[model samples]
Target chain A: MLSIKNLHANIEGKEILKGINLEVNAGEVHAIMGPNGSGKSSLASVLAGRENYEVTEGEVWLDGKNLLDMKPEERAREGVFLAFQYPVEIPGVSNINFLRTALSEIRIHRNLPPLSAKEFLKMTKEKQELVEFEAKLANRSLNQGFSGGEKKRNEVFQLAMLDPKLSILDETDSGLDIDALRIVSNGINKLRSADNAFVLITHYQRLLEYIVPDFVHVLYNGQIVRSGTKELALELEEKGYDWLKEELQGQESINTK
Target chain B: MMEKDDMMLDELANKEYEFGFVTDIDMDISEVGLNEDTVRFISAKKNEPQWLLDWRMKGFKAFQKQEMPQWQNFKMPDIDFQSISYYAAPKKQAKYASLDEVDPELLRTFEKLGIPMSEQKQLAGVAVDVVFDSVSVSTTYKEHLNEMGIIFCSISEAVKNHPELVQKYLGTVVPHTDNTFASLNTAVFSDGSFVYIPKGVRCPMELSTYFRINAENTGQFERTLIIADEDSYVSYLEGCTAPMRDENQLHAAVVELIALKGAEIKYSTVQNWYPGDKDGKGGIFNFVTKRGACRGDHSKISWTQVETGSAITWKYPSLILQGDHSSGEFYSVAVTNNMQIADTGTKIHHIGANTKSRIISKGISAGRGQNSYRGLVQMGSKAKNARNFTQCDSLLIGDQCGAHTFPYIESKNNTATIEHEATTSKIGEDQVFYLNQRGIDAEQAIALIVNGYAKEVLNQLPMEFAVEAQKLLSLTLEGSVG
Candidate 1:
């Protein structure tokens, strides 16, 4: 459902994500783990088509569409959703109104009929229950004064409403408590289908315990250097990444000799 | 005076007029001149009584000799009084006994501006008096108000029927010699609203006036007076929108109010006059003086205004707290867009002890517009324990526009306590980025921020007027963002 080839990216003239390649098919969860400034979040941002990130060399496709050329809203309408690490706070604009406008814009892009007020409200309630979000927050201003956990749950709730083909979760577990992480993971697990995919970006293995990943990839510097089964995350959790770095140095010396 | 002299000496000083337009309406306009004879001509044409004519003559005398005051934030061109037509009315008899008699040209003009006229004009409610140029063409729901002993009618008709009431409160709050504009309005004011609420009566509906300017080169000097007797309550709203015109129209208006013991009056104004183009050429030079006096204990007067038009606007709707425990409040949101210049604020004079006053003003300037908030809060020696709170905020949409605040505070007694707060900022690109990420466009984003900034004042307007004000802000902000 999504593919990236030699993704080279930079921000403000500093190289970040370099020569990164990955592929995730439907019904699969891929967790990309790395240390600080290791391009884990940069890969997610580049995939989501956020501006200000200069792509020197890259190719990213979502559902067979060129994601790099599309505008942010166009990418969103094409079923590519990015759950931002830091969601924007739009004061005075109600959350429901914002979601409805987004939903309508997507519907118009796909030639689907717009949802009426009744249908929209009913769907919103179902999503709130599924994501365990505070129902009262829907009518308030978008993300204004929202707690950390509430913001994460709202992202999942929106995920449920849009039913996107691919959702890149960027540090979704950063500020959430144990229960909130479980709720967000469960919401993602329930929304999982053979026709959809998710690229979970995080440094910890705790989230994988709930939404079990199909594969694990370790991002180092600017590229994916290691790919293994879900067991690899548990291994990294126990031994840490120093062993991998030591092994890489040994391999480089052997190759030089 | 120094500023005036500078403006006069600047040879390249050319004020561009943007909205120079004249709708296709049959008009009966007086020749251009400023004198007692011109006042008599207007009074005689309106069939005014002998006392009213004599009063107009007195106002004219005051207007002719009175020098225009300086010390203002705005710069006015030397007005050729000889070049201004004093009177102009729709050919349709300036009087309408019923809605059915309303002129088609007037209705079409309102439709062009998207002003709802009937009950459905607003979903919440609409009780409007549609005025054309210098006359009240039609007033809605007057009979019901009359049943409750509330007298709401055109000033000219009031002088004819309720002579005693008109003679009693006409200039009681602001006299004929109050200021330059007030003196002029008092001199040749052709028509406007006159409202009287009897003792112990509550007005049944919200009273509103929609002023339309359909003539070219004609100054609309309309006077409005509202009096609430002992134990009475009333809310009055006035708004105006003129079609684009090139020649500058002079509108110097005076509104006076008198509140007896235990009475309350709330006045709201949403003035969207035709503002000039970016170069500042042709538009209305609005000079207005409005004042309300709380004559008895426990009386209250509140003024809420949203000003978004006029090439040059100079007005201060003031209140005189004359009785013990009397209260006065002013809430204002002034938006000057597209070379519009607005110099406005309020004056709260505490004459009685223990009086209170509050002032809140929000000014937004966009597209080379110059907006200023000038206000005063003064306390008399006997006004012991007088309290005043003033807050002023300005938001600039672009670097070219300017926003200013000048507040004058005076206290004679040590017991008088006053506090002031002011802030200024521009609508930065970061704010727009956040809103746009949520799928809202730039225009909608600016409008939302502006409305939020002006929420306190917008809340004072009737729901319909509030919506219209929002739309006005949006249109005014269009092409204003860099």
Candidate 2:
């Protein structure tokens, strides 16, 4: 459902994502694994159309439409969801009200009727149950004074609410405990459908254990150098990225000779 | 997104004031100038008794000696008192027994202001006293209130009909010699609402007054008095609007409230006097003095206001807690946009032991507007174990706008517990982007943020006033974001 070809991006004149090429069909799960500074999160940010990142060269297509031409809000309305690594704390804005506004905006963009107050509340309750979010947390300001686990759970709850076709979870499991990880993964698993896709950007193999990926790619130096099945994650966990770096150096020297 | 947001803000900046149209009606305007003769003319026009005329002469004498205040940060142009007309009222008879007797054009003016003076469209459960320029034209629900032994009528009507009540508590809370504006207001104050609730009785409905300024170059000086007798309760609200003009008009008003033992009084105000055009050419210079006195034990007084319009606003609504265990509260949300200036706050005086007071003030400044909060909390020596809590917050939308806070506190007894909290914040571009990313437009985002900032004060308003206040806030802060 999503395709990216040779995506070149930078921030402040420094290139971050040198060249990224990826394609994912419906019902497929792609896990992008890399170490710090390997551009995994940068790819997610570029795909989400963050203003700070300048797309130097490339094209990204979502449902046969050019994604780079849209604003961040337009991208959001067009079903591109990014679960921020650090959710913003919007003081004084109730969680429910913000979600309702967002839902209405999306509905208007899609030419659908706005949900009634009762229907909105019911949907919110259902989504809250699906993500196991606390009831009181939904009434307070958006993510204000929320615990780390609760913030992640709120992101998942929002994902359930929006029902986006492409959801890029950026390190959502970083600060989550084992129980939170299980709940988030179970929520995502329940949301996965044949018409949608998931791009899991994570640094550790721990998350893939609960929500298994169909394909695992090792992103090194802003490029995906190794691609394999789910077993590749176990191999990487057994042997860290140093061996991969050494193997890449050996291959570069051989090519030079 | 930033460009789109900027464009939207541009459109909002040029939005016209919808209530700026003037009603073409003949008026009974006073001769230009301020003097004893002018005050006497106003008194003669009202057919006042000798004591009331003498009181006006005293106010005029006091006003001549007092000087205009200069302590506020706002700069004021020298006002030519001689150039302003002291009184202007619609051409009508002295007394109207019913609505049909009132002038049709005057009724149309009220209708244009969205305040239907006609009986069929009058607001239910709320009695309104409509003040047109210098005189009260109509008062609704008078007989119903009278049946309950509650007196709600124009100040002139009260002086003629209920002389004893009017003489007993006219200026008890705010005397004519209190301030320059209060003195001037007393000297030629034409008409306003007067309410009196009997002992142990609760006012059945809300009491309201709508003040409108129609005549050019006329100064509106209206006085309001509300007294809740022992063990009584009442809720009073005031609103005002004016026509657009090229030269600034003056509106100096005085409001006094008194609550006796075991009584409670709640006062809410939504002041929407015409704020000048975008260039700040002409608007109302609203200088007001409003104060309440808690005279008996366990009495309470609360002031809630939403001020969003005016070229320059200078007002401080205060409360004197003279009774033991009496409580006073002030909740205000002041918004200034496009060169509007507002310097407003409240004063709380704890005179009796175990008294309590609370103040919550929110100020928003945008588009070169200047907003300030100046407050004072005083505890006398005999105010043993008194307590006070104050919270002041200011929000600025654009860099050109200004927000200020000045709080003065005096405590004579060590047992007084006073706490104060203040915060200042800006609506930054990143905050806007954060909301934009959630599919909310910039205008909606700004309005939401502002409403959230002023939620505490807005929550204190009555239901009808709350909705109107919300709308006024959005209108005032529109296009303020950069």
Candidate 3:
């Protein structure tokens, strides 16, 4: 469902994602693990079409469309969703209204009829239940005064509402408590389907316990150095990225020789 | 969505003033100058009685002693008062018996401005008084207003017919010597709406006045007076537009409202004077003095205004709570875009015991526009247990725009409770990106954010106007951001 070839991205002329390559098929969950500044979030931002991250060399294809050529909104309409790690607080815009506008825009792109207010409301209620988002939060300004947990849950609620084809969860468990982590993971688990895929980007192996991934890739020095099954996450949790750093150093020295 | 948003923004950025076309009707315009002769000419043209003419002379004298104000945040080129034509009225019969007798060109002007003036197409349950340049051209729903003993007519007509009512309330709330602009407006004011709701009577319909500036190089100085007698209620709305001109025109209007014991008065204004082109070469300098006096116990007055135009706007709609337990409220949304400048707010004087006031102001600045909120809240020594709550919020769309807030709160009584809160926010790239990531374009994103910012004040406008004000807000800020 998604492909990234030699993804080289930069910010302020400093390269971040250097020679990164990845791919994911339908119905598969892929976990990209990395330490601080490993370009995990940068990769997500590049895929989402953030203007600041200039893609020096890359090709990102979603389904059959060239994703790199699309605008941020176009990427969204093409079913590429990025759950921002730090959600923007947009006061005065109600969550319900924002969701409705997004849904309408997506529907227009698909050449489908717009949802009526009643149908939209019903859909919102159902999604709210799925994500366990508080009902009152829907009427307030979009994440204006929402707590950290509420914001994350709201992002999941949006994911459910949008139902994107390829969902990239960028550190969705970074600031979650035990209960919030459970709720967020439960919501993601429920959203898992046979036709869609998810890219779980995280630093800790804790989230892998809830939404187990079919493949785990360790990203170091802007490159995915290793790939294995779910057992790789358990091994990393027991050791840490320190072992991975040493392994990369050994491989670099051998290549130079 | 991206292309469509850009197109809409381009259209709004280059939107021409739809009401810029001038009617071909002959005008009775005064010579270019300001003096005793100019004031007398205006009064004489209106056929004012001796007392009113004397009032004009007093105002003229007072204006001579006052220098132009210099304390505002906006910059202004020195106004050439001597070169401005003080009065310009459409040459027609003093009183039109019906719509048929009015000039077709003048009627077409109204139609183009979307002002429903004909009785058949008039807004239901609303009385409209149309003021063209400096004269009241036609007043609709007069017979309906007369049946309820509600005297709604031109101020000049009020002076001739309801002289007692006019004399009692004229300049009562805003005196001729109030300020430089106030005195100037009083001295050469031509004509505006006059509304009087009798005691114990609620007005049968909303009272509205549409003021249009047509003649070039002429200053529109209109005087409006509305009196809500004891135990009465009335909602008055005023709208303004002007023809496009290269040289900046002056509009110094004075509106005085009086609410007697147990009465309530609601005054709303949607000021859309031309804001000049993108370079801000020509437009209107709107210097208005509007004040409401709650003269009897328990009287209430509210001022709601949406200011989106005018190259230079210096206005303060004030409320004087002179009666015990009186209340005053001011809700305003001011948008300045593309080199426009606006310094507007409200003044609340709590002079009576237990009086209260609430002020909500939203200032949105875009492009190189500058917006400022200068408000004054005073609690007198005798105003025991008075309360005032003020909230001022500003939204800056781009780095070039500016927003300023100057709040003056003076409480002589220790028992008064005054609270003021202010916030300044920018339309950050992240906010726009977030909306875009949700499939909403930048234009709609900014519009949504701005509308949310101004929702509190927009909610205060009357129903029909709220919709128009919302659209105007979007129109004013379109293409303001890159």
Candidate 4:
């Protein structure tokens, strides 16, 4: 469903992601577990078409379309969804109205009739039951006065609404309690399908226990050091990332000799 | 959307006010001058008493001796009073006792101006008194209000029927010799609405007046006085839209609001007077003197205005907090576009102990327009524990436009607290880019952001009127603001 060849990205003239090549097939969940400052969020932002990042050398193809050439909104219409690590707070704009506008814009781009208000409300009520969400929060301004836990849950709620083909959950468990962590993981698990995929980016393995991924790639120094199964995340959680640094140093010494 | 529009001064000539056209009604006009004779002519025509005529004569003399005011951010050719016909009333075919009896042509004129007197009563959820050219043609909901002990009618009628009430409060807030324009309006002011809410009664409905200047070269000097007796309350709204004219038409009116002990008065205006073409050819020179006095303890007065579509607007809706524990407030949104200039603000005087005042002003300027807010807040010696807060913000759309704020605070009381804040910035391009990334077109994004900026003021309007006014604001700046 997605392919990237030597994707090099930087922000503010500082290189972050260097020569990142990855591929994800349908029905496969890929987990990118990395240490701090491992260029994990930068990779997600660049793929989401955030304007600040400059892709110095790379090509990204999503289902045969040039994903890098599209604007953020166009990428959104083409089913590239990034559950932001920190959602922007837009004051004086209701959550429901913003969601409806986004939905209508995507529908218009795809030559579909705008969803009727009744249908939209019905869908909202259906998805709202996943987390037993309080409906009052929907009427408030977007992300304003929301707790850290509530903001993360609301991002998942938006993800459920948009139902993107390829989803990237960036640090979705950074600021969640155990219960909220379970709820967010369950919400993502229910949405996963053979035609859809998710990239769960996290620093700890605690979230991996709930939303177990098919594969985990260790990212260190802006490069994937080792690719392995779910056991890799548990191994890093046990010993720490210094073992990976030692492993990368040993590999570089071998290549030089 | 359309590749960014460059500044187009070529279409300036074509942007003349489409509604600035002179009507063909035969007018019984005063002679082409203003003097003691003109004052007497007006007082006599209205059958004024001797004392009233003396007051008019005094005001006429004051107006003659006084020079035009030069203490503001406005410049205009000296007003030739001799060139303006002071009193220009429509020649009625006959006296009409009912709304239908009045000329549909005249009512249709109001209709074309979007101020149907009948509908403003029936549809707009308010009573409307239409002052066309000079005379109050009709007043709606007067009888209904009278049942509630509310005397709502025209000023001229008030002088005839409620003589004592009119005489007692007419110039109490805004005196005849207050200024040049006030003196002129006091001398020959033809007609305006008057409301008197009796003690202990709340006005059941909003009272409104629609002023239209239709005749050519006619100066509209209307006087409106509203008196709320002890413990009474009333909300009044002033709305106006004028026909397009080439020469600058003088509109010097006076409105006085008096709220007795424990009384409250709220006045609002959506003034869309005729603004000239883009190059500023002709429009309404609206120099109005509107002031309110809280004469009794616990009284309150508030003024909220949305002023746009004027060539040169020079008015300050002010309040005098004279009673103990009284309150004053001014909330305004003034927009100047296409060579329009507005020097508008408010003044509050805290004369009694425990008085409070608040002022919030938002100014938007575009296309060579100039807008300014000049305000004053005073805490007198007797005003112990007085407080005031003011916030003035400006949004500049075109680089050539100007936005300014001048706030004057005077505090002699030791226990007074006053805070003022202001900010100025043009609509940034990065904001537009962000909204565009969210799938909104440029215009939609601009509308959303501008509406958000003006949310505080728009929320003060009634629900239905707020929706219409929001749509009007967008329509007024459809092609230009972004």
lDDT of 4: 0.82
Put down candidate 1 lDDT per residue, B316-365, tens digits, no spaces. 99999998999999999888876788899999999998999999999999
**CAPRI-style quality class for the chain A–B interface of candidate 3:** acceptable
lDDT of candidate 4 over A1-257, digit per residue (tens)? 89988899888899999988888888889899888999898888888876678899989999999999987778878887888787756555677877777778877887888889999998888888865566888777767789988888888888887778899989999999999999999999888899988998999999999999999988777777778889999999999998888888998999999
RMSD of each: 5.9, 2.9, 3.2, 5.6
Q: Write the per-residue lDDT of candidate 3 for residues A70-134, one digit (tens) a residue.
A: 98999999888899999999877888888998999999998989999999999999998998888
Q: What fraction of the true interface does each of the listed models get right, in terms of native contacts kept?
A: 0.12, 0.46, 0.76, 0.17
Alpha-carbon TM-score of each model against the true structure? 0.86, 0.92, 0.93, 0.78
- Give the DockQ (C-alpha) for candidate 3: 0.48
Top-scoring candidate (DockQ): 3
Q: How big is the positional error of residue B252 in model 2, measured in Å on the Cα after superposition?
A: 1.2
DockQ of each: 0.16, 0.46, 0.48, 0.17
Interface RMSD of 1: 7.2
Predictions in order: chain A TM-score: 0.97, 0.98, 0.98, 0.96
Docking class of predicted structure 2? acceptable
What is the fnat of candidate 3?
A: 0.76
| Candidate 2 structure quality by residue, lDDT tens digits, B1-482 | 45644565566558777689888888889899999899989999888999898888888899999999989878876899899999887776546888888777777777777775566534567788888786777777788888999999889989999888988998889997999989999898988889999999999788888888889999988899999999999999888777788899889999999999999999999999998988888988999999999999999999999999889999999999999999999999999888789999999999999999999999999877899999999999999999999999999886678999999999999999999999999886666666666676667778878887888888888787788788888777776663
**Candidate 2's residue-wise lDDT over A42-130, tens digit each?**
89888887777899998999999999998778888888888888887777878898899888998999999999999999999988888
Kindly report which residue stretches of model 4 are placed more than 4 angstroms away from their true locations once superposed: A1-87, A94-136, A145-257, B1-53, B71-82, B93-124, B243-247, B279-281, B365-369, B395-402, B421-438, B476-482
lDDT of 4 by residue, B96-150 (tens): 5687888767766766667656644566568877778777777777778889889
